[model samples]
Target: MSGRLSGKRIIITGAIGNIGKEAVRSFVAEGARVVIGDIDEHAGRAVVAEFGGATHFVKVDVSSEASVASLLAQGVEWLNGLDVLAQNAGLQRSGPITGFSQTDWDALFAVNARAHFFGAKHAVAHLKRSGTGSIINMSSLAGKRGGPGLVAYSASKGAVVAFTTALAMELAPDNIRVNAICPGWVDTAFNQPAIDFMGGANVQQQKIAALVPLGRQARAAEIAPLFVYLASDESAYVTAQSFGIDGGVYNG
Candidate 1:
């Protein structure tokens, strides 16, 4: 690691899971001290232990605005301030529009879409104090191009893209950057919903081969670097962009 993030203080939500875990490792490796926020206390504590002193964990339910506010309050205090916020927590529910209950739809928006807003809403004060800061929201390729069975999930993630764009402009004057990462099929248990909707792992693989130009799913490690880049000063001039790491699924 080149210590690209040396002296940076970061807060990452969903740090117990695949992509979030990998991003935490990458951030720490690049020399950032991080506070992890998640709902699972057991897994969050284990991650803190795994990372030693460079990381701390704060229990949070991203879907709750109060929970998110508390997470940021505690996290910023722990880190002594804040420089980056990675809103990586999300929920996915897939089914036909007719069959998708309103309950699931609301749940999806609460976590996938509204959570980003909640996080940014609370994180802005701490970030502004840093003079320059970054916010990375995780969107998806489904958000960019709505798929057959992903109406709700896609709608929620699409909201993220719009949020990122508008927030970037609003925060740019504060030297705060906002961006979205729209990834395609990354190989993680996180994809189980889509896989089940596709029938099974085998069918998902077949579909990936047909849809992705790279003919495979990306690994979590492959996606973490993008998080690191956005969080670091390397992206000082980058903002308001929804970057696609979808293996050429959508060129636009």
Candidate 2:
């Protein structure tokens, strides 16, 4: 009956999304109290409400300093301290450079890249006070390799990976570990349009699954434990590294 995250207080940004929602469940099931922050108030409340009063939900636009500040404050107030900060909010858009609008690029980066920056910045204060906290940033495989239509997402994820390394080094002295998880081809509804446009449901899925040596996309639940490991003493000495939960796509 040992709980890996017993008594831990975690704040997961973008907690309303598919993978984020699943992570919430994992964190809770492992005995951690979670505070969720996301732009989707309805989904965020609904999801957290499913767990009832045990979890806290906040409306946060990670791109906004005030929103990030408010969310962190609420989390700190509710949990008394913070142990894990999972920066998991992001968005993806497709358009070639020649046809891509600069506005689109800015908008996407605000949520996908800049939001990570702000979330970590604000969460750091409470985490540092909690002593020996862990920071896990959500990255994507697109950041590792270039794709024709995925420039913005790829670049943003690349930025997140780099940020993880640099932050890890800077925060190591505080015993605060920082890491990144780059997920690949998750079979969630997030990419449904791309899958559907590419072909029928089964065919599209098969094609994507074929890319990974494992012959399938990932599940959010599958990725959550990595965060738990990174957040726990089991990985006490692990930091500044990026682990790919990408179905052997990166072969790491």
* Root-mean-square deviation (CA) per prediction: 0.6, 1.7
Model 2 worst lDDT window (10 residues): 191-200
Per-candidate Cα lDDT values, in order, are: 0.95, 0.83
Q: How accurate is candidate 1 locally (lDDT)?
A: 0.95
**TM value for model 2:** 0.94
Model 2 over residues 1-252: C-alpha lDDT tens digits? 258888889999988877888888888887889999988899999988887665999898888988998998998899889999999888877657687788878887888788878878888888778778999999888778756667876888899889899999988999899999888888677766345445557876677667778888887888878877877778889999889888787864
Task: Write model 1 residue lDDT over 1-252, tens digit each, in one string.
Answer: 799999999999988889999999999999999999999999999999999999999999999999999999999999999999999998988889989999999999999999999999999999999999999999999889998889999999999999999999999999999999999999899889888988999999888899899999989999999999999999999999999998999998
Error of model 1, residue 185, in angstroms: 0.3
Supply every candidate's count of residue pairs whose N, Cα or C atoms clash at under 3 angstroms.
Answer: 0, 0
